[model samples]
Target: MRGRIIVLKHNTPGLLRRIASLRRSRVLQYRDAKGVILLDILPQGQCINAARYCSTLDRLKEAIRRKRPGLLRRGVVL
Candidate 1:
């Protein structure tokens, strides 16, 4: 399966719209010039982990699953 990370130089908005077409990506490290663990993809989108919604990543997968189950069921990048 193909996978990639969402990156931003600093605090920005509307990332989901920018990469909305990409369904199987994780919200990896962002605004961290020094490099840090922003998001971690476990089994692409199907197997999302806790790290994806914490700290620098801030994916909010948990919330998405509860509120937006469709997002996860959507077709993956793979």
Candidate 2:
């Protein structure tokens, strides 16, 4: 199966800096032909670097094992 990674950005406009701190988060998703395989929400100000990506992939592997055990045996394309 082939999978895709989607980055969803959530933005709020026009907030008073003094009154309230700005809040933002990023949604990271992994989906295959069937449906969403894994989803993660990154905390505000976090960036997607090698270390983070590696951790996310580790989680993804666990998810795959739990959700679709046969996928790994069949081989997957990312």
Each model's lDDT comes to: 0.45, 0.67
**Candidate 2 — which residues are off by over 4 angstroms?**
1-23
What tens digits encode model 1's per-residue C-alpha lDDT throughout 1-78? Answer: 455544445534765465655566544432223443233333344544465334323344454455456756986511
Total colliding residue pairs, candidate 2: 0
Candidate 2 lDDT, tens digit per residue, 27-76? 66787777777767676888899999999999999999988888888876
The top-ranked prediction according to lDDT is 2
Model 1, stretches more than 4 Å misplaced?
A: 1-59, 76-78
Q: Estimate the lDDT of model 1.
A: 0.45
Cand. 2 TM to true fold: 0.65
Q: Estimate each model's TM-score.
A: 0.23, 0.65
Clash pairs, candidate 1, are none
